[model samples]
Every structure is written in C-alpha cells, then in structure tokens.
Target: MTRHVSTRRAATAAGTAIVAAALIGAGLTTASAAPTAEKTPGASPTKLSASQRAELLRDADAEKARTAKELGLSSAEKLVVRDVVKDRDGSVHTRYERTYDGLPVLGGDLVVHETKSRRTEGVTKAHAGDLKVDTARAKAAPKGARAVVWAASGTPRLAYEKVVKSTKKDGTPSRLHVVTDARSGKKIFQWDDIRTGAGHTQYSGDVELGTKQESSGFSLTDTGRGDHKTYDLGGGTSGQGTLVAGDDDEWGDGTPANKETAAADAHYGAALTWDYYKNVHGRDGIKGDGVGAYSRVHYGNNYVNAFWDDSCFCMTYGDGEGNAKPLTSIDVAAHEMTHGVTSHTAGLIYSGESGGLNEATSDIFGSAVEFSANNKEDVGDYLIGEKIDIRGDGTPLRYMDKPSKDGKSKDSWYRGIGQIDVHYSSGVANHFFYLLSEGSGAKEINGVKYDSPTADGKPVTGIGRDKAEKIWFKALTTYMTSNTDYAKARTATLDAAKDLYGADSAEYKGVDAAWAGVNVKAAKGKNKH
Candidate 1:
C-alpha cells in the first residue's frame, strides 16, 4: 500500500516584553552577532550595562539557587540562564537550560519568573521531577548509539536505544529511545526523532536582501539575522548547492528566466519573516537564539512542496511546474520558517489535535508575516499560498475564513477531530484565529473579502490582529505543551490574553468568545494565573 503523506510533509521531517518596550527594542536589533555565552555554574556572564549587568547577575544567581533548591537538583545538575527579560513593572522572566553532570540535558529546560523584589514567583519546566537515574547505565549500540534527530514533540533529543524494533512498512529502522529508570533500569521516555525544512531571487519580484560581504563577492547570507543563507539546489533533490553570490547585489528580474530570480524571492521571503518575528514578538530568529537557519531552493523538478527540517536547521523549497515557478512566496516562506519556530517552542506533537495546532501555528504566523511586510505585490490577506498557484487553478491552498472551502478542512472543532489529518484538523484553529482577529459576518481586509461565522451562531467581536497574534504567540511560548489538545488550547490562549492584558480585560474575554465560536469550550473553573 502507498503510505499517505501529510500536507505539511517534511523532505525530512521535522517572546516576552521588557518593561514591554525594552523586550520589543531588544528584538529590533537585527545585526548578526554572537549571542551571550551560556554561563556555567558559579561563572557570571555580563549582560546589559555595567550596573544593570551586575544587578542582573546577582538576581540571576539568586533565582538559579532558588530553582535548584525548589527542584531538589543534585550537585551534578546545574541551571544556566539562557535568556532574561525584565518587564517595566520589575517582573523578570528568565529561561534556563539544565545540565546533568556537566552534560547538557535534552528537554531539560525551564523558565523562572521573579517579582521585581527578586523573589521567586514560579517555574515553567519542560520535563517534570528530578532525573535521579544514572546516565552511565544508559549505553547505546555501537552504530546507533546517539544521533541528533528532530522529534515531533518539538526540540531535538539525545535518543539512545533501549531496544531496537523491527523495520516499519516504510523500510526505515525503528530505534526506540531508552528511557529506563536510572535507579531501576525502568523506561522513562521514548520517541522517534525524524522530521524535515528554503529560497530565492527569481520568483519574488524586485526585492532587497541583507547579504554578507565575503572575499568571494557578496554572498546570499543575511548578517543582520543569524547568517541565514539561501542556496541554489541546481534542480537536484539533495545536498546544499552553491550559494547565490555575485559582485553586484541586485538579484533578479520578475520572471524565472534567470535561476537567480527564484533565489532572490526566497532570500527576500526569509528576511521578511525574520523581521516579522523580531519586530512583532521580540523573537530573534527561529530558535530565538540569534542563529539564522539556512534555506535551499530548486529541489527536484516540479517538486510541488516546501518544508522546515530541524535536523539540519534549514528550510527547503521546490519548483512548482516544469521547474518554472518556485513555492518561495512571502507567505509560503514564512509558513516554512514558522515551522521552525513551533518546533523550538510549544512543540505540539505532529499527530492528533496538537499536530493540527502545530500546522495552524505556522499558517497563522505566515499570514501575519505577509501582513507585516505590507508588500504591494503580495498584498497581505487571510488566504494561504494564494500566490503559489499550488492547485493549478487560482485557488489558494487553505482559506482562513472558511477552511472547508478546500473540501477537506474543518471550519470548526468537534469530538474525535484528532482522527483527521493535521492539515484538515488545523482548519479549526485557523478559523478561530480569523474570527478572533477579524470577527464574524461579511468583511474585507486588505481588499480580500471574507464572511466568517461561528459554530454556535453567536457572533464574535474581533480584538484586532495585533492583539490576537500576541495572545496566540504568548500561549504557544509560555503555556501550550506537546500534548495540549484543542480544549487545552482554549485555556492556554485565555491565560495568555490574561498575561498580556488584564484578567478581566476585553482581549481576555475576546479569546474566550473566539474559542467558543470555534466550538472549543474552555475548561470549567480554570482560573487565570
């Protein structure tokens, strides 16, 4: 039997404020520079100005000690600050990566929230409880011992085999993660890490790109973000081809007459998406670590798809028909890059309701990025892949207003929704987002006409895209987890709105109404934190 492929197939598989303004300001800095080094135990790294750096170090140390004590961390385990943000009100949110016996602990990360007074408020951990198991006993096979692969759960893990299973129908070997209890050799966790990810000059019209100045002329590398480069695949399916470099910076004309034209479009799309995240959410690049992911274009002849692969931390794009048109439009580029963002954060599982949310997250942000660009040619809208002509006819891949227009997506949520494909199930969240940002009834945004309705027949009042995007982003980063279902999504967005706005604010209520509009009910008695 021929196996089915997800609409979001991978060639492989695969935010906060300062005083509010400061966090946004920090994100606006696009210059490519090495991020602060990960501070080791008892070793302080400088941040901010002299005075502020000292103060931050002191506060960070105290918080780390508090976290270690609260979590009952052993001497071998240490908490290292990855990033820190301070609100204008004095509240501080510090993200940390845990290390076990000087070795990095995959999935062992957490966030520490502290009051302006330097008191520990709470912690959001990726994994629960202390790791009391011995690492020495967790040995791996000689050949399949350890490999870094992308897991559907979000971030990559150091997977080792406790047992190797029989090969699957796909002719791929199955190496189950060895999650045995450190003390009793009992299994603790297990998952398969495989997933797959871009760019341009010819396809995207006339556009400006940020490239790095190299001895071999200027290369298609963005120095402003994380050295993100766009390469020409030379029509081949695999391997990173040559970089689109030249002495003159001007990339392409409108048509794919020149191979560089498609590359120019792909390159420009990546830059815009990077700017969107940085300017809107204060996120610096996909991983939020100031590292730019690379993009590969022209994969195979008439490849028809694009993807974000975490294994290589890059994006890949394919030509549409006869290798003439490439799927490297602004929205499509942003859509692929947003996949990288989802993988690093909430990591909603790649199957079931969570998987739908994962795909919707990309679509939602991809649309937002297009709107942010305000490009006259693309013209931001609620439609996805409208420019790509993926369907041969002029119809877009998916419609945010009425997802069922494609005949496979669900405009609203219902029980057992997880049984459907992720691309189809994602319609529920996409519809919810549209209703929340644009409201119900007939309307036109950026010249695109849309008539959105609620499953409950109760009209919803939109809170504007600006607020809606922030709320969804906050929920994804701070609240939603790998297994968060649709119901949990409702609660998470509500909590996110409460955090950004007040608990009783209009935006908070708008989130609740929006969820109800999608037929996703809020959990009973779930109060805002």
Candidate 2:
C-alpha cells in the first residue's frame, strides 16, 4: 500500500543554469595532478577550476548553433548546454538538453564530440530523427499537467508531465513523474525520481567532520564541501525540517538513541562521499558545480528506507524498524548520493533497462566510496547495507559478487529484464561491476568472502577496483545517454576503457570480459575472448 500526500511545487526548471563545465581546450594534452593528500593513482582526468569551467562553457555555447544545424535540428528547436568533457588527447565532448518551441523535450539530450580543431567527430542522441511535432496547445490533458515533448521512446509526441509528491508505504519519499499524451488524454509513460535503498546501523565511527561556527555555537554545515548541511526532519515525512546544530563541536555518542547521533552519521557520510568524488573522480559535487546537497534524518517513525530527491536537492533517511537504527550507514549514504550523480550525468530515466543501469551506477560508486573511506569500524566489502539489517535477520540488503543471493535479483542479464523492477534488474550490472573489479570465482577482501561465476563458464581477471571505477565514471559522463540500455552500456564502458587505457590494454579486455561474464557479450568479431 502507498500513501498519497500533496505538496505541489513547480517542476525543477528545465532552464536552471547548467552547473558543470570542463577544461577541454585545444592543445590541452596534459592531465592535472591530483591533490597530494587525496591523490588517486592512475586517475588521468583533471578537475576543472572555476575559471576553466567558464571558459569551456563559453566554447560549448558558441558552438551550439553550428552543432544543432549539423544535427539537422529544426529552427523551432534550441540546444542548451548541460555539461562538457575533454579527453587527454585534446578532444572535447559537449552535452546538451533540447527545447522544442519553448517547451522542454524529454529524451532530447545529446552529446557532440569534436577534435582539437573543432571538427565534428560524432554525436550521440537520446532521440534520433527530426522533431516535427505540432506545438499547438492540446485540446485535453490531466488537471494541472504541464505540456512538454516526450521523445524518450517510440515516436515523439506532445505530452503532459505531472509530478505527484507523496510517501511510500516503506516510508520512502515519492516524486512520481506521470506523463500523459496531451492530445488523447491517455497515459504514455511515468517514472519516480525518488530512488530508495534499505540499510542497517550507524557504522561510521568517530570520524572527522567539516563544520561551521554558527552564531549559536556550531552547525552541522560543512563549509568546505559546498556548504552541505544536515537537517532533522523529526517525524514528519515532508519538507526540509530543521537544520541540526549544537553549541560545542562534539557530535554523537555512536548510538542511534541520540537523535544527534544519526545527524552526525549523515553528515559524515556526505563529507566522505564528497571527498571520494573530488579526490577519486575529480567531480566537484553531485552536479559538478561545487554546490553541496543537504540531508534529512529521522524521517517518519520506524521508516526503513533512505532516498535521494533531485527536486529538493537533498537526501532523506528514516529510523529503521524500531526507530533505534537509522539508515545512515556509510555505504547507504554514498548509494543515495550517487543517484544524484547519475541523474545529472546520463540523466538515465528511472525505468526499464536504463533505470537498472542508474541504480547499478550508484551501487558501483557506493561500494567504491566505502573502500576509499577505509574506516576501521566500517571496513569495505562487496556487501551493501550490511550494517543496517533492515530485514532484522542480520543479512545484507544485496550482494554484488553474486546478486542472486537475495533471491530476487538476477545474477546475469537476460531477455525481458526490463520488465522487472529497477532494483532487481540492477543485479546484472552489479554482477558485472563485481567481476570487473574482483574477477570471477572465489575471493576475499577486507575479510568478506565472495564467489562470482561467469555466464559462459569462462574465467575473468580483474583490473583492480581503482581502474574499474575510473572506467565506469568516464563511460557514464562521456558516452552514456538517458536511453542507454544494457547493450549500450557495454559499448559505453568499452569506449571509456579505451579512453583511460589503450584499445589493446588489459583494462579494456577486462571490461569486455566482465560484460561477457554477465551475458552481455559484444558482437562476434568484437568478442575476442
């Protein structure tokens, strides 16, 4: 059962200024050095400075007119720059979102690749073909349904996108997007942006946090990382709630019984996640704009779920089962935050195979962030939500090495996978990531044992977690689009691997082998193995 609550806020504006940019200028052949203390070995891409981002953004904007014309876009369509990336070889990739006759065009996003001299190399579009839909106002639509163009799948058509704000039975906040065909007043498609994951105890130990000295003592705001703050939603299920603060800097006694304890855990998770992206992947923040998203704790009594909402630009967690265990574990926090990353990058629609990929992207990064944290109390492992025990049986929520351990998730990709829920469908990529990072068969890391199997009974050798994560991040931000399915995902990762490692490098082979391990084999000639 689900509960419907009404808090009507306008959709996150499509015209919101693009926050991320790149430093991919001509003759930029060398990569920038990582910060000494947080350096990640073999991480080649450079982080963009504020001035560089502005410069690259200007470059992207200046080229949009010519790029759109080359793509054969109609005069009624306009392109807005969403992001930009550059390779070490002096090549640039600019991402854009499309608008049709002043209305947002869902699934009209694209990436234009160019060489050092601005020669058009290629383009990846979420929607192919021309946009010739009639812009005249539809005769009928759902009450308060805002008009837009739906091009994510099938044929492009005028549609209404309605967002219903509510709370799920599991206490997960809902931001359901309901799309209806405007002309016929019929349902076309819908997807919820509120991504949910279950979790266990507050495992983040006595850790360092970034806090600000407020007039009223100290606030849970981290001034260094985009001023990210934590709030206590109390028992209510909506709104931002109150910002958590205290006189002294000391926070939490490592117990969920203390409301401040959960707040501290949430705050710590945000900081660690921020550090992981900035240090490991050179990402500034969730949107790559150096702006932090907030967090809310104690949402709904006995609520056993944690979620990330793009509309509110924040994360919300519930006190699990007995209200004694808050779902603010380190992995859980990273898991939710990574959703925001996926939303901004690939904008993977939260449905079908793309949704599964979206969820897997988060899981992959969440696991990576955990290992990078290297906390003694919360050792990293392939297991997710191992500390929260949301099921009360002391078992984890999901297993990456072999996702079938949960009995609901599939261990490998198969036909009809898109028909299942995204969480379960995510097992395919989750298994792929595990194989890519740790290889097939039995292994142990940080005292956790895992045994992964291949679809064709073939053995796979890992290229290490560090390399695996870098490849995934590159593929996601550079090659992937919203409609990318499992097959497209394989190509994206392979392309990313080729970019980071050479086309003939072992890392590239590892990516192919990992995909084949999960039954996502490449075309005959391409499957060298």
Candidate 3:
C-alpha cells in the first residue's frame, strides 16, 4: 500500500519478468558530470544555448558513471543521470534514475551530493541493497490461478499467485501467501501491487513556460521541470497523445483564439508548481525526484474534469463546455501535481480521512503556488477552482475560509467524518489551513474577502501563509504516513511547526489552535512540541 513506483508490477502485468531477468545480466552504467562552472540563480535556464546545455549534460553523464562505480553498482543495475543542480556555494546534487536488470526499478533512485571542491560528500538512496533476486522459476500465472501481486519493501519482487480455499466471507478467496523453507520456494514477499489515486488549459492569462528546443523548432516540453511534456489529446481519450510541436517557441496570444493558448497556460502552471517546490521546500520536483510527469490536454469533447493518473504518471485535462475553455489554470495545475507529491510522501490512501487529507493537501499547496506566482492577471485567492467556473455560477468550487459555503462540504470535523466522501471531508482540513494562515473572522487579502470561523467560537491568530506552508510541507514529507488520519494530522503539523519554529514559538501554538478550530484533537500521549 506504500505509494511508490513499482517496475515489477508493470512487468508482471505484461508477462515480461522473465525477459527482464535476462537483461539484468548485461546492465551498463552511464554517468557524466557537468563542468565545474559556477552559475547564479537568476541566470535564465532557457537562455542557455543548445550547445551549452549539451556540454552540461555530457559532463553530467560522465559524473553519473563515476558515481555508479563508486557506489559499487553491479552490472545488474544502471544509473541514468536525471538532473545536475549546482548551488551558488559550489555544492552540487546530481539526481539519477535507476534501472535493474534493464528494467525500471521502482525505489532504486538516488542523489549524489558533492562539495564545493567537487569531493563526493555522500549519497541519498531512495532504496538500498543490491537487486539480486532469483527469477528463473518466476513464471506467469496460469488461467484461473487467482492472481495476487507481491510488493516487497525497499526492493519489490513479482511472483505467480495460487489461491487456497479457507474460512472467510462467502465467495471471497482466502488472502494468504505460500511459503517454504527450502531455497527453491520461499515467499520472500506478498502484498497488493495496485496503486491508485486520483490539469490544464487556456484559462490562465499571460504566463511563462520552460520549453524544449528541437531540430524542427521548440516544443511544449519543459526541460527545467523534470522534462515535463504537454500533449494535445486531439479529442481522444487514450495513449500518450501527440506532442504539441511548433516552429516558434513563443506560444499563445493571451486569448483562446488559438488552441496553443491553453497549452501555454498548462505549461506555465507546471513550471510554476515545479519552481514552488524547488524554491520553497528544496524539492526537485513532484515525488522529490527529478523525473517529470506529463500533461494531456484536449481530452474528450467538452470534458469538464481534470485528474492525475498514477498509472500513467501523468495529468489529464478535458476542455470545458464549448471546447474553448481549457481547465488548465494555475491553482488547478498545482492541485493535480500536489497529488503526485502526496503519492510519494505520506501516501495518504485516497479513501476515508486519509483521502480527505490527500485532497486538502492539494488545495493547500495549490493556493500557495498561486500566491507564489503573484501573477497580476490571476491574483491569488483562498478560493478553489475559481478560474475554471465549473459550477457555472461565479462562485468558486470550494471556499477555504468557509468551506460550508459550498453546501456539501463540511466546515469542521465531526464523528463519522471519514464516512463522508473524501472531497467533502476535505473541507475540514481546508478550513483549518485557512484559519491557520488568515485567522478567524473577516479579513481581506489581495482584494479577496474571507470570513473564517472556529467550531468552538475561539478566535485563532494568523501565522501567515509562508510559514504555514512550510509547516504543512514538512509534516507531509517528514511526519505523515500512508494511513494518517485527522487526529494524527494534528500531531504531524504540530511536530512540523515545532521543528521549524521551535516548541514555544507562536507558529507552533497556531497549528494546535487551528486544528481545534476544525474540531480535530491531537492524540493523547503523542509527542507534543
């Protein structure tokens, strides 16, 4: 149930495990380092000439090879340089994507940290240990074998399943793993491999994007943000779709008169969200890994919804109503990308209270990203889906200050709150975040009015959005787990606040008060800061 990439899951589904095993014997490593040149932060990444970027990548590749050898990576493993980030202090962090036995390894990525003098400081591995699993007898399941997936911790292994009848619910198969002490048959691991969780268009006004330079010209692929690419679905619902290619890199005219306008908005949103995480939280990208997830626009005819699919590791959006209004707004794009972040960290299952927390996390960061952009055309607000107008009315889909304004969303937590739909239950946490950042009662920010109230009628003081965002992000990445509930969330944020602002700081007090405002109590006996 842990949220992570699973290469074996896909291999098992495709019956390619055997072939992958064969390829593992001849694995090769490629790593290069960038030139030891100092670059400032304000230097425009897009302004780098094609030749300059090529030279940088070439150096990075060499560094990757050296790093893999230093790490003692076996021939069954390969390291692919994903990004090489150089700090002003001359330190560098080189991120890599890993493959095992020529197949993608789910939790095998790592980052090599170097000092200003280019000395290897150490490495941060996503998962440790050599991937040496026996797959000779790992055959595809036969018909009616009762397929069950096995996902091991750190390193996952795939094996065929065999069902056994036992005492359980009627028509329900027994959930058990077959094991043997003999070396020939040992159930190394067993768990469900299915992972599910739950972007863009022309609505956003004049914005900037990171695009890819091509031989024909530039395309809508963002090299700065983990190489995220945007594609036009062409009104279809399947496949990776077609890449949005054009001769000129400059896209969109600030109006829906051209379809590229929507594409531009989506691309811009992705870039903004990427920058928000990198600058604010020191995260490389969604999943804290350099790999980028793509966006698919123009999905279906007048499709009004946008969703993040973990299966494809991409975000899909539908043009709304007349196909002219694309759903790719700044906040919406951030919201979807934050879902990917949640999947990698905390991994709140998209059901029950955890599901509600998952949704609210997206809403929280989505608002942060909007404010971070400081775009004049789309001023930041505490309203969700305000630009999309999915409701037809001028009102936003969800109100953080007063979530109950949506009629269906809850303003505060209560018993059986988990029984409610995740989207509605998310209102409680959204209200808590608003109260934490803006306090209770009426206030105005960026020309938007908000009147947040407490369930206990106790006034809560504001801590500002910047501090609140850091606390939440810290809790998500450091404290939360896959099944964190509301009460647990209260503890997590409190711990996060203490870690960032100290136990006696006002920021810590605000986190506790905000949860109380939402009727969530910190668990007794839990560490209090």
Q: Report the number of backbone clashes for model 3.
A: 17
The sequence of per-residue lDDT tens digits that candidate 1 reaches over residues 281-358 is 767778666789998887777766777766667777777776676778888888888888877766666667877888
Residue 218 lDDT in model 2?
91
Residue 463 of model 1: what lDDT? 77
Cα miss at 432, model 1 (Å)? 1.5
Query: Which candidate would rank higher by lDDT, 1 or 2?
Result: 2
Query: After superposition on all CA atoms, what RMSD does each candidate show versus the true structure?
Result: 12.0, 9.8, 13.4
Better of 2 and 3 by lDDT: 2
Ranking by TM-score: 2, 1, 3
RMSD of 2: 9.8
Q: Ten-residue segment with the worst summed lDDT in candidate 2?
A: 20-29
Instruction: Give the per-residue lDDT of model 3 (tens digit) for 1-529.
Output: 0111111111112211110000000001011212122123311112222343345456667655555766778876788765543444444555566765555544455555555555665554444446675544444444534322222233355444543434222111123334221233455433111121111235555556788899989899888778999998888877888898889877877665577777788788888898898887777777555678998877777766666766677776767767766677888888888888877665665656877888899889888999898887777888887887766777777889999898888999998998776778889999999888878988778878878899999998877777778779867765565556788788778756765566767777788989989998855643333
Across 239-294, the per-residue lDDT of candidate 2 in tens digits comes to 89999888898887888877888998888989999999989777788887789999
Candidate 1 clashes: the total is 40
